[model samples]
Target: MSQFLRSSSIHEILAFFGDLEKTRLQSISRMFYDKIIPSSLQQCFLSLLTKDKFFSYSKEQGDILYYYDIPTRTWIDVKAANHQEHYIYYSMSAVVTDLNRVLLIGGSFDPEFEQYTDAVYDWNQITNRIQPLSNVPFVSFDNGFFYYRGYVYIIEGHVDLFNQSTVRKTARFNVLGNYWQTLPSLNHANGKFNMCAFKNGFIYAFCEQMSSFYRLNSNLLGFERSTNWDLQYIQWERILIKPSVYFGFKMAVFGLNDNQILLFGGDDEFNNQITHSPISKEFSDANALKILDLTDLSLHKIVDDANQDLKIELPDMFYFNQLSEYNGKIYALGKDHIHIINLSKKEIEIIKDDGDYNEEDY
Candidate 1:
């Protein structure tokens, strides 16, 4: 016995689709595709935004480094540096590693002291608090920090701030151990310096007299220099030049959202030969900050150029130093101005008031 079933013809199918409303047909097709196809393929059909994450940047209420959750858009002030007996300084600059570990390095909060930096604080995201370490690190600044070999390696620029002569070579704090270990001293007595981190474990130390780039090997002890990256700058009115010399010595070094590394305003000894003053006379009067792209090794200065749509007001006297990126936006803490740059929009927004810190009054 043969079984017979009604088979829909091509004409019937075309007639059914032609008779359906546009919206109804679209809805039906979507539903059918979603039900029939696997999620991996169906996901390709949907459009997605650029995934702009949002985060907040705020000074600590008392004296502590804070972490803001990008997903939930919430701030968690880690009160890890508060002193119960005597209120000590809580100065910090943090780096989030590959494993998502936040390492808030040492700095001074109190301005009364000349030279003194407390212990390095490690805040584990798993625990949501500051983690304790066995070894205590000596005082240092963000100028001496670079992430290498899954560890935060530190270069002790100046041991004594008052002395200004005591040179403490270099060291590293194992993010895993939370301990401090010293590395080999620099080639010379470089008490003040700035380091730029690059791809393939390359770290560039840019200073006044000398600038050198090195590759941090897997052992962490192995450091090989690539070439002598000479430091110099010529003030041009409107020409584009690559910045080989780092102007921002103590300021912020940022990898921009637009795939560029921004070196903000920093102080350094004068290298220009055009100065009429004594040869020994060191000048820090140059206020022009630089923005360099590592991809093509191209450099551009942050100026009042009509071509570039800068969103924030550039700092005047105060050196804009520290850089921190949150929620796809870059926030810069100058000596006076707190600048927030929206990378996606290519616009800059400035926050004038800094709580208690005064640049001019000081």
Candidate 2:
């Protein structure tokens, strides 16, 4: 047995054990492996092993990548090996693949150059390397981006820098094939909207500028690689429900269930009046929470059983750029904090980054 354990390949050893035994042996192997490996390498390996973690990349913070450990309740910085190869990326979109890699999509690398990028990068969590993938067909920023199944979708966004004009274009990139395909365009042209995918294989997009809620049934699209699918036949159904005008560009929207979605926190316009300054009193509604019911097409604010309004405010540094979900909670990634939404409890817990660079209970 000892000779077999020492001589066999990792695949052979893994295949020989049952599921429960494999897990037990993995835990034991990690315990012994940690003693010999460097702390940096151990962090990278542990990140891949742990499933319940949130990876956050903020262009505002330059090339540093951070991840929140749900079990330990800490945010640790995972330094990139080739962070200096690219400049700071702003208004970019990121999605974690099934292979445990983070893919960063289109965004502007430098404001001075006014250059928007079509470049996509594949960031490996284990090797801590950021490598360039195929470039997107078009350059845009602040687009509605999300990952579903094995593909990443990029929705309408600003096409140019000076004019601030948006396009109705939408596209999807095959993660495994490393290729892009243009999908059907949206009915409206808008940027900075909230987008999410449901378990029923429908992609939902909500744009406050157009006051439009649209969804596409991906299952009917037949996007397999072998098929010569004509995208023009595909259509996005514009939902009839008119969302509140206050649900502005920065609001975070996430799926609650098959027939429900939860939206909160954004630049709120009070009385149909827009506030110009970022520091204006009515600039943001950080505590507003609403649930959209698709069954009856009703939009209503969520309240507790006592008929009391639930007041949960996002942290001051919270950015609604991208969100991740694990278990039953939705993790809203921010510049220095992560706001966790507990669906069952209707509560929000903040994981704040102290000056020491560690996330703690707030």
lDDT by candidate, in order shown: 0.43, 0.59
Candidate 1 lDDT at 238 equals 23
- 168 Cα displacement, candidate 2 (Å): 2.1
Q: Worst 10-residue stretch by lDDT in candidate 2?
A: 353-362
User: Candidate 1's C-alpha lDDT?
Assistant: 0.43
Q: What lDDT tens digits, residue by residue, belong to model 1 across residues 1-362?
A: 11111112221232222212323433666668555434442222221111112111223333344444333434455444433223233334455443234565654454454545456656654454554344345655444565544466665543244455534455566654456665544444332554544443344443332232333333344433322222122110122232233342354566554456665444442234122213232233223445655565565666444554242345332222345566677766554555666655666777663333333322
- Best candidate according to TM-score: 2
Clashing pairs in 2: none
TM-score of each: 0.54, 0.71
How many clashes in each structure? 4, 0
Segments of candidate 1 deviating more than 4 angstroms: 1-82, 107-118, 124-131, 134-137, 141-143, 159-168, 189-191, 194-196, 207-249, 257-260, 266-289, 293-299, 302-328, 342-346, 353-362
> Residues 1-362, candidate 2, lDDT per residue (tens digit)?
85434423332333233335534644667668555433453343334434566666645455677666676767678777776544666555567654345887765465566565677788777687777788787765456777665678877654343454434677788876688887766765443444554546677776544345778877766666643455566678876644333455445677666888876655442224332213222334444577878887677777766776554464332333456566777777654556777767877787765322222311
